[model samples]
Each structure stands twice: as C-alpha cells, then as structure tokens.
Target: MPTVKPRLSKQHQRWVMPTLVALVSGILMGLTVAPVEAWFLAWIALAPLWVLVLFPTQRLKLLIPLVWGIGYHGVALAWITGVHPMMWMGVPWLASIAIALFCWIAITLWGAVLVTTWAVCMTVFSRGVGTFTRVLIGVALWCGLESLWSLGPLYWSSLSYTQSPHNLVILHLGQISGSLAVTGAIVAVNGLLAEAWIRYQGSGIGNRGLGKSYKAAMRLFASSCLLFVALHLVGFGLYSRPLVQPPQAALKVGIIQGNIPNTIKLYPEGLRRAIAGYTEGYITLADRGVDAVLTPEGALPFMWSEALRTPLYSAVQQKGVTAWIGAFGEQGQSYTNSMFTLTGDGEFSRYDKVKLVPIGEYIPFEQILGGLIHRLSPLEAKQVPGSPDQVFDTPFGRAIAAICYSSAFPEQLRYQANQGGQFILSAANNAHYNPSMPAQHHAQDTMRAIESDRWAVRATNTGYSGIVDPHGKTLWISGLNTYELHAETIYRRTTQTLYVRWGDWLTPLLLGLAVVFKLTSIQASQK
Candidate 1:
C-alpha cells in the first residue's frame, strides 16, 4: 500500500510563505558582505521584508522580520561556530554542540530584534504619511538604531559595509556623516522601492487611485534618486581631494604574519617556536630598512617579564628602529592583552587592550560562570582593561593602538583620534575565526580610516594583514594562513572629519525629524 503524506493545517499554510520570505531576506543580507562580496544585493535586500511589512495579511508581520533576522545574522556570523571544536576538548561532543547552538541563537536573536522592532515601528508610526515621509522615517529609525548600538561592542555589519571593496564612490559618504549616513541612504532607496511596488500592485494605469499613488511614489523615488546622486558626487569629490595635508613624513611600516596555529601557540613549546618565528620575520624586515616593525597580537607568546629577558627586546633596542609587539603584561594579580612599543633608546611604552571579547576574554557573571569557564578553557586570570585615551608617542607619530576586539567600537578609535592621534594601529589574533570574520573585521577598519581621515596599519596573525589609506583604499593586503612580510608607506593626519568631530549626533536628530513628520501627517489627516 502507498503511504499518504500528512496535510498541513490552514494555519501552517498561512505562515509558511512569510517565513520563507524572511529567511530569503536574511540570506540576501549576508551576501552583501565578503565571502561573496555581492555588495549591490544590499540595495534591494530589504525589499522582500518591506513587501511583507507594508501589505496587510493574516500572517504575523513582526514574526516574519524576526525570521529574517535569524537568517541574516546566522549566515553573516557563522564564524562563531569555529570555537565549538575547541570546546569539545573539555566537554562532550553533545555539550559542545549545545554551547555553540546557544551562542549562535543568542546572537542571531539579538540581531533579529533590530529587524522586528523596525517592522513594528513602520507598521505603527507610518500612519497618514506619504511615501516620501514614510521612507524618511524608515531611514531615521535605522540610523538612530545604528548610532545607538555602534557606541558599544555589538556594532558589526552596519549595512554600510555592503558598499565596501566595491563602491568607493558611495563609501566616500562615510567621510561626512560616518557610516550611518551611507546606511540611511541605502534604506531610503529601499523604502521608496517598497512603496512603489505596493502602490503599483494595488492600482491600475489611468485610474484615479493609480494616478495619485503613481505621483506620490514617483515624487518619493525622484527625491531619493536626487539625494543618492548628490551624496555620490560629493563622495567622488572628497575621494579625489585630500581633506588634510599629508603628514610631514611617512612610516615605512613592516607587518609580519607568522601563521602559527592557535593550538600550538598556546603551549609552552609553542611559545618558544612563536618567538623564533617572529624573530626571524623581524630580522628579514629590519634588513629591508623598515622604519618600524609590527607583529600581530600575542606575538611574544610569553609574559612581559619573560619576553624582556629574551632576544626580541635586545634586537629592537639594537636595531634602532621603533617596534610594536603584541604580548602579555602583568601588574600585580592581573594581566592585559597588551601592545608593547620599544623605542631606539630601549624605553618602552605599553598600551593595554580595553575592549575584551565577551566570553573569550572575560566571562560575564564571573562569580557564577568562573568554574565552568575554567574547566572549559585555558584562561587563568581575567584580562585587565587598559585606560582609555592612551596614545603612544611613537617615532612615526602620535599613534593609537586598538587590539583585537576593540576595533568593533568606532568611538574608541575616534576618542583617540580626537586626542591628537594621527594614525591608527590595529593588531589582532584572528586565528580562531573563519575567513568571513576577518574580511568583515578588515572592512570595519576601513570605515575607521574614512571616518577619522587617517591611514591604518592592520597587523593580524594568520591573515588579512595590510595597510589602508585615508580614502579607504587598500594599499597592501595579505592572504589568509600565510607566513608573509609586507611593507607599505602610511601617513599620519591631524585633520578630523565632521563625523570625527560631531560623532553620531545625526541619528537622534533624524529620529526627531521623523517624529515631527509623523505628527504633522497625523494633524493634517485630523484637519
């Protein structure tokens, strides 16, 4: 006898299509960044979600966008799974899988909340508004949310990155309003498209309803087109012109990638090997006449005391060139993820890492999770955070060093730049993450270069070590999992852009304007 498939209930059928739309929207969002680098997809990526939100249907509107969030964040941040196998060493396979799933779900849900909230706001606050006003409100909501979150640690993939490594013209908009300006412009265009689609579908040519909708939609679309064109034209102008005079001189920076395995580098013998590997790389670069030599985070593999006794210290002092090496520095009972800078005079200036990775650097609620954390990992003492506004007086210029995860917060580097920082130095240990994370991370630094109008020196262990100019151009880039030494001429600038001076004040201002427009629309409808 043939078996019959179970039939879905009417309720299930109602939800299935919207769920698929959400998931598709999420996947489109992920494709906007690296590993695929289809940046243009971001322009229309939100249209599907807009279709779901703008049309009145029996399906839950908020729920659909939540699903979209899960799809988007899940794909974009899949690199978090790389830490799971390492967890397997201490926990059972099932437990490791559970841990990974928990993290993945938690982060995905957090990002999903942004999408869900935006949909709800549009559904409620967009009443009695034309397409232009509605689209402007949408832009405000997105920019406001982005500005609020960018001040903290969870500011990855702000949608502005969708233009990077491809759309340099649009990317230049970052110099004026920072990344949020670019984000607002993209969302406005998306909003106009969504409005036009809904209007065209519900009405016909030459009909009164169709004529009104067409005029409203076209007006909004024309306004959006004009704003986008103006922004790009200004961006092109800014890209061609240097906002600040070039630095009095340049730093012939040498960035070294030892390509040491994370597992091996953590062991005692691995520590010795890491030092040997880095020392050899340094000798090669120094011989080539670099003004300064840079190493990735944890290049020393030993505590500051032990590293001082080693040949790395003597070599830097003897070579008579400035050096920045990543290592651990202890003070009393705590140690920091530190960047140690040695001048030719043998004097050292230390800049400790302030923004620690959530679970990897320090477990939150340590009083409770400390035992479980210790059992599952090799960390002994929680890493100490360094003081903010700590600038290093390097021979190159007044440089600010952002270690590993600190680059996630734009404010951290911005503060340093405001305090006379000329160039930004980012040193990272990206060995534990997948390829996608490194590409995204590098894109963030490029935003920093544009926002602050400063050249960037990125030194990473295992890959993506390169130099970025003030115009957000990649001067020199490296491949992943390779042992290579690359050098580039980097300049330091003291000029600050509008974004660097005013920060993200535009977001709240836009939000206020949106609120006013909505209220005006409401009052006009009442009249």
Candidate 2:
C-alpha cells in the first residue's frame, strides 16, 4: 500500500500558519532595535505579516498584527522589568515577580493594541486598492498612529529608531522628513516585497494565471529595487549637506558622570556622597580649562536652597567658568527636577523639566487613584512638571535643556529650536535603569540632534554620556556605569533643519487623508 499524506484542514490553514508567521514577524521586527540592533532586518521584518494579509483566510487579520506587536514589544521593552523592580520597591519576592511580569505584559499589550489597531484600519481601508496604494496606506497609517501616540504621555519607541544613530548615511533622511520619512520608506519596501512575493508564488503554483502573475511579480520587484536605490541617493544628498558650525566660537564644554550606584542613590548617606562626588568631578573638569562645566541630573541630590548654600556653589563662583548644574528645586509644596545655570558673575537661570515620567516621577490622576497606587507600590514624592517653554540663557549661548524623560518628545525640542535654541543640552539620571535603557535613550537624543541640526551635549550620571554633532554622529561617547569627565569643544550651530520649521505637520495631514481614503474605499465597495 502507498503511503498516505494527511491534508491540512481549513482551520489549520487559516489560523495556525498565519498566527505562527505573525509571531515570527514581530520578533524579527523587535530585533531591529536595541539589544539586538539588526537594523537591516527592518526592511524585511514586516514582509511576513504583510504577505499574510494579502491572501484570503478565515483567520482574523487583526490577530496577525496583534501577535506581531506583542512579539516586537515583548522583546524591545524587556528592560521594563529592571526599572525599579517590585522587590526593589519593597514588595514581597513572589509578589514582586508577579508585579514585574504584569507591568511588562501590560506595556507590551498596550503597544500591541496600538499596532494591531493600525493593521485593522489598514485592512479595512485597503480593500480593492492596488499594491502601490496599499503601500501608501500602510505608511500613512503607521505614521498617523505614531503621531497620535506622541501627542499623549507615553511616547517611547518609533520604527525609524531601528535604523539608529550608527547608520549615519541614511539617518540624514530625518533632517528633511523627520523619523516618519524613514519609517515610511521602510514600510513601502516591505509592501513592495509582499506584493512581489504574492505574485511570484502564484506564478510558481500555476493557479490559472502563471504568465500574468510572473510579469506582475517582476514589475513589483523592479519597482522595489528602484525605490531602494532612490532612497539611498536622496539620503546621500541630505548627508552631503555640510552643517557649518562656527569653529572659532565653539564652546569648550566639560561633562561629568559620578558613577553612583542605584542601590544608594536616594538614601540619606548616599545624598551626602553624591554632593561630594559631583563637587570633585566639577572641580576636576574646571581645572582642565573648560569654558563651561555641565553636570548630570540630580548630581547635587539636594534642594535648590541647600545646593546654593553648599561649598560647591562657592567653588563654581570662584572657578569663573559657566556652570550648568542639575538638582532638585522646591517651591512651597511642589518639587521640580530643574537645571540651574550659574555664571561666573553669579547670574542665574533655571529650566525645569516639563515632561514627567508617569508612575516613575509622578503618578497620573493622583487625586483619584493615588491612595490605591500607594498601597500597591511605595512610590511617593511626586516631581512637579515645569513650564514647557522655559529656555536656559547660558554664558556660552542661549541653550535649550531637556532633562531625562523630556528627551523622548521631539516636538518639545523642536519648539525650543524654533525659539532660538543654538545648541541642545540634555542632562539625565540613568542610574536606576538597565544598560539597554540608556543606549536606547541616547539614540533618541541623537535623532533630536539630527532633526534640529544642532550640536547636542548630553550629560548622564552613571553612563552613555556624549557629544553629538549636528550630523548625528557621536563625536565622543562614555562607557556605562563609569565615573569620568569628557572635555571637548562642541560647535554651536544656529541653522534649523526642515523638521524644526514644519514640525510633524505632514503626518497628521496624511492621517486625515488615510481616513478619507478608507471611507471612500468602503463607499466604492458598496457601489
């Protein structure tokens, strides 16, 4: 008797294969970011999911993108577990494990929901649309969703970040079109590949249309190749434009990292050590002939009044170099994470942090849910958010400063740039997070530098501090968990990039167009 082969049922074909493909696709997409950083993979990462949506199946298309979002976010955001883990927050061990898992899963699911919603919307809108139209819809929907998320409080990662600050050549695309342009280009390529794939497979299987399918596949493939080449060429043109910084007027800035361990960062004894550590670090840099010394966030580890009363203020006053210090500033019942600038003649200016990290710095809707969250976690002492429009007037130049979490929002920085921010200044306390967090955070700042066309001086406590030029190249970067000072002369440019001028106006416009197209497609289908 001949061996008999069992055929796959409709349910297995529709559900099992699509689900597995979506899962694998999401994982690969996630790998294109930090901890793995296989950026080239981003070109093809969405192909599997894109292909899945092309064919007919009883399987819910919504579930395909949902699984992808879960995979990508689950891996990309794994470091969330390390951010003030439940045990560190004084919860019981078993409960701590459960809490950490819950937090991670919650964040992953939230991101997944946003992504899956986009997929569903795209599927509905893309009915009867050609491959090219589908690609445009995908790009528009993705950009629109990112813009929507950015308008909210929890803006973290974007698809363009997958390319990273390392890919200097292509990253210049950000200067012209911002991160959305890079993301759109990547999606378009994925769509092209998916279209080519469907057609090619149909030809191979000879499903009653071999000749036509092969020709269509060849055209799509050729178009994808042409687009790939054209994008790189455009990138090269943008990259070739020199960002001319005034070499003669370059500010010699010094940065310090105190290497404070997270275990003792906020304790009484640790606060004393932090003051001493940063004082010494500041003196060390001032002695090295720096024109200005920049310190990390919470370097003083005390209230503004106490910081002024300390010997460190006298040291800075005597050193005669401009000093920008990050410390806690208090006003009555409110506390702000502020950056204070002390000139040689004792003139002072302060820029408070506007964007507070939810649940970490300040709990949202604390009036209603504060009591409940307090019982669940020991989070107390909320840091009040500062004015979004404050700019620091430094002796070196008029600068804009983003403290820690504020760096994640590009529009805030763009607004500052529009307000005559010569060069960007960022100070951070990354002492409590994992190494991966800082790397990813640092990458976000790099995009800001490129987007605004300004030199960025980033000072962080306990790692990944560096000077990024207007071109988004890391001129100098410090190692993680190390105490050190980097002294370099950074060029301050006044020129603004396209992103700074128009901001993200293009994305919202595209989003509106997407809605119109979707509604029109539905109407046409009915007709």
Candidate 3:
C-alpha cells in the first residue's frame, strides 16, 4: 500500500511564497557585498523585500524581514564559520564546531533583528502614504538604522559598502557625509524601484485605456531611472575633483606579511617563528631604506616586555628604521591589544586598540557565560580597551591606527584624521579565518580611506597587504596566505574631507526627516 506524505498545515502553507521571495531578495542583497561582489544587483535587490513590507497580507509582517535578514546575513557572513576547529585553542573538536556555529547563527540573528526593526518602522510610517513618501521613509529608515548600528559592537555590513572598491562614483559620495550618504543614495534608488513595481502591479494594464495608475507607474519607473542616473552623475563630479596633496616628502612605507598559523601563533614554537620571520622582513625592509616598517597585528604574539627580549627588538635598534609593530601591552593587571611605534632613536609611542571584538576579545555577560565557552582570544586575561582619542605620532606623521576589528568603525578613524592624522595605518591578523574575511576587511579599509581622503597603508598576516589612495583605489595588494614584503610611496595629507569635519551628519538629518514624515502622516489621518 502507498503511504500519503505528511502535508504542511494551513498556517504554515501561507508562509511558503513570502518566505521564498524574501529569501531570494536577501540572497541578492548579500551577493552585492564583498566576496561575490555583484554590485550591480544592489539597486533592485530590495524591490521584492519592499513589496512584501509595503503591502503585507499576512498578519506576521515582521517574520518576512526576519527570514530575509537570516538569508542575507547568512550569505554575507558565511566566513565566520572559518573560525571552527578550535582544537588549536584547546577546545574539543565537536565543541569547537558548536562554538563556531553558535557565533555565526547568533550574529546572523542579531543582524536579522535590525532588519525586522526597520520593517516594523516602515510599515508604521508608510501606511496611508503615497509612493513618494514611502520612498523617502524607506531611505530615511535605512540610513538611520545603519548609523545606529555603527554605534553598536558589530558594524561590518553597512549598505554603503555594497558599492565599495568597485563603483568609484557611488563611493565618492562618502566624502560628503561619510558612508551614510552613499547608503542613503543606495536605499533611495532601491525604494524607488520597489515603489514603481508596486504601482505597476496595481495598474491593471490589460484595460483598453491606460488608466491613471498605469501612467503613474510608468512615470515613477522613469523617475527612478532618472534619479539613479543623477546620483551617479553627482558622484562622478565628486570623483573627478582632484585631491591636492600637501607638498611633503613621500613616506616610503614597508609592509611585512608574516604568514603565521593561528593554531600555534601563541605557542613557544610559533612565537619563535613569528619573531624570526618579522625580524627578517624588518631587516630586509630597513636595508631597502624605508622610512618605517609595519607588521601585522599581534606579530609578536606576546607582551611588550617579552617582545623586548626577542631578536626583533635588537633588530629594530640596529636597523634604525621606525617600526610600527603589533603586540600585547600590559597595564596593571589587564592587557591591551596595542600598536607600538618605535623610532630609530628608541622613541616609542603606543596606541591601544579602541574597539574589541565581542566574543573574540572579551566575553559579554561574562558572569553568566564565562565558564561555558572560552573566548577566541589567546590571552588568558581580559583585554582592556584603549581611549578613543588615541592616535600614533610617528616619525612620518600623525597617523590613525586601526588594529584588527577596529577598522570597521569609520567614525573613530575620522576623528583621528580630524585630529591631524595625515594617513591611516591598519594592522590585522587574518591568519585564523578564510580569505573572504580578509578581503571584506580590506574593503572596509578602502571605504575609510575614501571617506577620510587619506592614503591607507594596510599590513596583514598571511595576505592582502596593500596601499589605498585617497580615491579608494588599491595602489598595491598581496596574494592570500603568502609571506611577502612590499614598499610603497604614500603621502601624508593634512586636507580633511567634509566627512571628517561633519562626521555622520546625514544620519541624524535622515532620521529626523523620517520622524517628521511619520508625524505628518498620522496628523493627516486624524484630519
């Protein structure tokens, strides 16, 4: 006898199409970001999502966006899984896998929560509004949420980054109001598309005469296309404007990519290898007559006092070239992830990392979850955060330092630049994760470079060491997992971009506009 397959319940059946549509939209949005980098898709990626949120038939409107966020973040952050196999960190194999999976899922859900929040706001604000008001509210809410998220712990996945390192025109908008302006433009275009499509569906085009709705839909679609072109044209004008560099000696900076394995980087054997490798690279670059040499974050993999005993210390003294090295620094009973600037004359300054990774550097709710799983850090003690006002005074010039995860925060770098930091020095250790992680990290650095209108010199363990010009172009970059040394000429410019002066001004303006529109809509309904 043949058995009948179990069917989904009526309630569950109602979710099938909406979930599929939301997922497709989310996946498209994810592809527009790094790794896949199908940036052209970003303009239309949100149309399906907008349609679902703008015209909801189901009672659970938030679920659509939550699922969409899961799909989007799941694809964008798939690289988080590369942290698995923490057996190197003394975690059991199965437990290590569970930890990695937990991190990925937890972060994804958190990101999804943000998306759902936006959906909730959009639904409330756009009710009883015309297409134009809907578009404005959509852009406002997106930019506002992105700005708010920047204030939170994690901020790697901003909408503006979708155009980075690929679409130079759109990226140029960052100079005006930082990445928020670019984000606004992106959401504006996507919102218009969604509005056009919604209007088209309601137009009933099969009628003999094209009704007002059909004409309105066509006009809206055309207006969106025009607005998209106009945004690009304005961006092109910004990109075309020449960035005049101050007349100063070009600093020849040498970058050392020490290919250290994360598993043994803290071990005695791995520590020895790191010392030898960086010492060799430092000496080689010094012999080449570089102004300074840079090593990846945690290149020494030990405390500052311990690093003093390594050959790298003696090498820096003998070589006489200024060196910016990443290592652990001790303060009282706490340790900090810091970047040390050592000049040939023995002058040294330290900038402790301001932003620490949530679970990787310090555990949240440590009182509750402390014993459950180990933090991803190699150090036993909790790492302390540095003052946000810290900037490195190097022999070359005042420089902004972004240590590892701190690179994702643009406002910190902008503040440093505003405080007379002429250039950016980003040191990272991407040895633990896959190539995608470093690439995404590199993209973020490029965005910061463009926004600040400063040259950025980046050094990383294992690969992607490079220099980016003020225009967000990669002047030099290295291959993944390769031990390489490169030197490039980067300028120290004192000219501050508009973004450096204003600092995310557009975010608040957009949010305020959203509030005004919502209030107006409610007032109109009452009348």
Top-TM-score candidate index:
3
RMSD of each: 3.1, 2.9, 2.5
User: What does candidate 1's lDDT look like per residue over 425-456, in tens digits?
Assistant: 99998886789878888887887788788888
Across 218-306, the per-residue lDDT of candidate 2 in tens digits comes to 89989888897788898888777876665676899999887777666667767777778777877888999998888888787667888
Evaluate all candidate structures by whole-model CA lDDT and list the values in order: 0.79, 0.80, 0.86
The deviation in Å at residue 322 for candidate 3 is: 0.3
C-alpha lDDT of residue 464 in model 1: 85
Candidate order by lDDT, highest to lowest? 3, 2, 1
Error of 2 at 176 (Å): 1.5
Write down the lDDT that model 1 would get.
0.79
Q: Mind giving the per-residue lDDT tens digits that candidate 3 earns over 1-527? A: 13333345554556887788899889988898768989888888877888888765655588899988988888888888888988878888998898889889988998898889999999887888767878888888888888789888887877788787899888888888998898888888888887777777787859415677777777888988999999899888878888675557489999999988898888888888899999999999999988999999999988998888888889989878899999999988999999999876774799999999888888888887677676476778778899988878887779989998888888899999999998999999887787878888888899999889889999998878889998888989999988899998888888887899988888788778777877888888899
The better candidate by lDDT, 1 or 3, is 3
Give the lowest summed-lDDT range of ten residues in model 2: 1-10
- TM-score for every candidate vs. truth? 0.92, 0.92, 0.95
lDDT score for residue 339 of model 1 = 93
